[model samples]
Target: MNTLQHGFQLNYGNTDVMLLFEGQPDHLVPCTSQILLDSDLFLVAGRMVGHSFLHGGPALAGISEAVVDVLFGASPDMTTITVEDCPDLERRQTIQLLDGNKDLSEEEKDAVWKLADMWDLPGVTSDNRKWLFSRLLQHAVLGRTDKQIKQFRRGLKETCIWQLLTERKDVIPLMFPRERDVEIKPQMVLDQILWPLETTNEDEDYPVETRCRIAGYLREFIATASQSSLRGLVQFWTGWEVPSSDMQLEIVQGSLPKASTCFKSLRLPGHYTNFKDFSQDLNACVATCDTGFGLV
Candidate 1:
């Protein structure tokens, strides 16, 4: 396993130099490992509201859910980290680090901290998570879904950016056109809508097959997160008036447009009728888009 070199010096401010060891690095400084520091900083800020740090690059993507696992100290891999276990085997160590000076029980520690506070962290913990998740959701919507975390982390920022759309009424502009009753066909959803945004994707070409795979999974995530069917999720994405039932059939028959691709493999319902019912149910679902709301 790749490990931080012992006695390595990471200078912070003018007065601080963090000392890393083979076993565990000091919590005060940064490290080369993305998951370790990212997980630590998130818990510290969410629970204590004072500690913060700057993180960059792809490794620290999905810091919020990762840290929640560490703080609650549970190893169950769900939506956040897909691996059955963390590669570093530091989940236990991570828990110890976050327990800190508080005397409260571990479960109490988790119950007290909220995701909104996590978003408020004044350093890279908040910034990187925001950027990472924005990228991930963007890839999913635009048709570039990922199956493995190592790959999906690449689009974390783009994914979270799209999630921010539901944050308020104003987000309607960036995601949906100003006109009402505008129903975007799957192909049109790919070409006309998602690709235009340069900020959402990396500056490189993407294959259509890859885009389709991503979109399929992303659609499932929307249904799962929204707790509705495929149809309801589409309504949420477009903000347009509901299309006729026959129109829904036409859209379903067509290929997945490039506008809605992702890198992850999303679990979706089997048939068209089921998807329609799912959408109707999703439309009626209570709004649950709070930051980190669907992470589980």
Candidate 2:
């Protein structure tokens, strides 16, 4: 399941382009790939979703709501489409220009007209320009990708979770949450840490300053870390990119920051006197720790 998750979400370790869905991190909408469609990859994607859910794997969250709505039988008019779901930048830019500006500049009008002609969509009139904008958003997002969506639905049904997915619409948010819904926060990773006994001895007359300083550095790093950095931390501490409930932290006086994936524990060096050294070493370890036995 993790392997499947990596292939879809990370595109088999290549992020420059995708073979299936498109959009920002958590708002993915399927972009039509004729080659992949012919190969039935989307159907396989559907099965991945079902199997992942059943087997307790990745949530595969961030799927665009429009795609989720259609997967669960929403009609064209009923599906909620967002501008982000439009995979084409030019068309999306034109739609954005048309969204609220009824009095478009001549250049903007030309862009929209060009987009309409490009897609064979209805042309814009001064009065109907607003209507055109909405239709363009819908078309760019879902209209052109209808068959791909259907294939995804068919694949999902093959896993027999379609009924539950359709009947319990509330589960949509849980199954395929919005990007913001599942985005990792600094405190989230901090909460996952089981601080060492040395750091916990707050009332002691003499504290384990080495342990506390390194532990504090870890906390500080997480607090200011990028999304990818935190994800790397999770992937390092656990075998997967998701955080676990029982991650332990151990401070060793001379060792570098490393994790025991099977134990969900992070062992950090306790000798660091400054945040820069600590962060640099920690970042180096995280950068190369996503693969097997990756500790340096």
Candidate 3:
């Protein structure tokens, strides 16, 4: 039996095998026959053995033809593998293998999670977390049992999956629908409308259009809003003082023409003599009038 530097060896049973080490504090790692046979190391060792048999090489100088055939032929026995000493590399290889295998058994998945925990691995990487999330989402859409769904939710929360889900605008509503809330806050809806306008990278006119549309929406939203919601909207708009175009200002003012009335009627925060006084101050700070008298 000859040993190679790269952990390859020709065993007495005429099998070509490559030793694999896994995990930290390296030990002779044993694995299932299927895992060992399916591994890249085994494939590479088989190729090397076949190449050696086809062309006379120094590595095969003393090996018998029958031995070479057995090593190179189908149904090669890789069971007599020795322990190698590269635990970190082997562990990473195992992780990549497991991560790529979407059809893993429940036991296999448990093993993967255990390995991740042992390594203190954060599921922040796309490769590490995407598959798990995909599986969880599939289970959710397919109507898993309540207990199973809760387990998946717990796992996702532990990995900060909600933060990632928020970035996916399409999935956020599905995962966290407004209907789930006992009482949806008007500020949350307002924030949703304003967030894009504040963070947009488009031309300045885009924000003007967005703000005008938001103002119109708010006006309609407040019409059916609870007293508390109306108060919230008034309090929010009062602190906003960015200058806008005349058309944009006009549309926004048109939407909330009765904001001051609502504030006073509800006894909301902030003091204003009347709705006209509040409207004048807001319009002046937000945009100039047709007469060029208000702040531009």
Decreasing TM-score order of the candidates: 2, 1, 3
lDDT of 3 by residue, 72-181 (tens): 22121321211122234544344544444366666656655665555454432336565543333222222122232233234344444445554655643332223213
Error of 1 at 175 (Å): 15
TM-score of each: 0.16, 0.76, 0.15
Instruction: Give the poorly placed runs of model 2, Cα more than 4 Å off.
Output: 1-16, 25-27, 55-57, 95-122, 125-134, 198-213, 252-255, 289-294
Query: Higher TM-score: candidate 2 or 3?
Result: 2
Residue 259 local lDDT, model 2: 82
lDDT of 1 at 137: 26
lDDT of 2 by residue, 1-296 (tens): 33333344335353644447776655577767676688788888888888777765567766777777777778878777778777677778888987775577889878888889888877788678777878888888888888888888888889988888777888767767665666789888788788867544655433587677777888899999998888888877876667778889887645578888889888887678899998998888888764545466
Give the range where candidate 1 is weakest over 10 consecutive residues by summed lDDT: 49-58
Clashing pairs in 3: none
The best-first sequence of candidates by lDDT reads 2, 3, 1
Best by lDDT: 2
TM-score of 1: 0.16
Worst 10-residue stretch by lDDT in candidate 2? Answer: 1-10
Q: In model 2, how large is the Cα lDDT of residue 218?
A: 86
Where model 1 places Cα greater than 4 Å from the true spot, the runs are 1-188, 192-266, 271-276, 284-286, 291-296
